[model samples]
Target: MPLLDAARAVRENAHAPYSRFKVGAALRTTTGAVFSGCNVENVAYPEGTCAEAGAIAAMVAAGETRIAEVAVIADSPSPVPPCGGCRQKLAEFADGDVVVTMATTAGQSATLTVAELLPGRFAADHMGNG
Candidate 1:
């Protein structure tokens, strides 16, 4: 299935209520497996999970640590960029040049790299210490 089709299909399962902003993400892993996730919102705004995060969680749960491609879709006029936390999480599994595709409900689309989305990201290696 096309990336867009996978994203659109997953978007339908989004559990968004407060924001009514549904998002979906499909990630292709280095193991040739595709994992899909949908945004799950909570009453507490900060507790909500982004689509990309969910997809990564699913991949990790399945023991897949590397991502080759990721496609995110939302019901917006323009492409929705991943949040800071999601960007950091993505850097853990995907390198700077990993394909990052964004799409909107109206068919608008854009592509970028993890590095372009989050420049100078601090990874686990940068943890602990001054």
Candidate 2:
């Protein structure tokens, strides 16, 4: 299935009682496996989970460490990009050239590479682990 379709499908399952702003994300791993997730809200706003992070966690739980492509969808006026934290999470598993597609329910969409999404991204090398 298309990543966008997957994301859209999962968006319906999002637990956004507080914000009512549901979001969904899907990612294709380097191994050709696809994983998807939806935003899960909590009473404590800061405890809410973003769709991208949930997708990444699902991918990691499946033992896939590399991402090839990603797609996210939301019901907003324009395409919605992942949050700062989620962007960094994506960078942790995807190369700079990996494509990230952000979309809106209205059909608007934007495509960018991970590098474009998070320029000057902090990496493991910054921790002197590389």
- Model 2, range 1-130, lDDT digits (tens) per residue? 9999999999999999999999999999988999999999999878999999999999999999999999999999999999999999999999999999999999999999999999999999999997
- Report, for every candidate in turn, its global Cα lDDT versus the true structure: 0.91, 0.96
Best by TM-score: 2
Candidate 1's displacement at residue 28, Å, is 0.2
Model 2 clash count equals 0
Candidate 1 regions with alpha-carbon error over 4 angstroms: 128-130
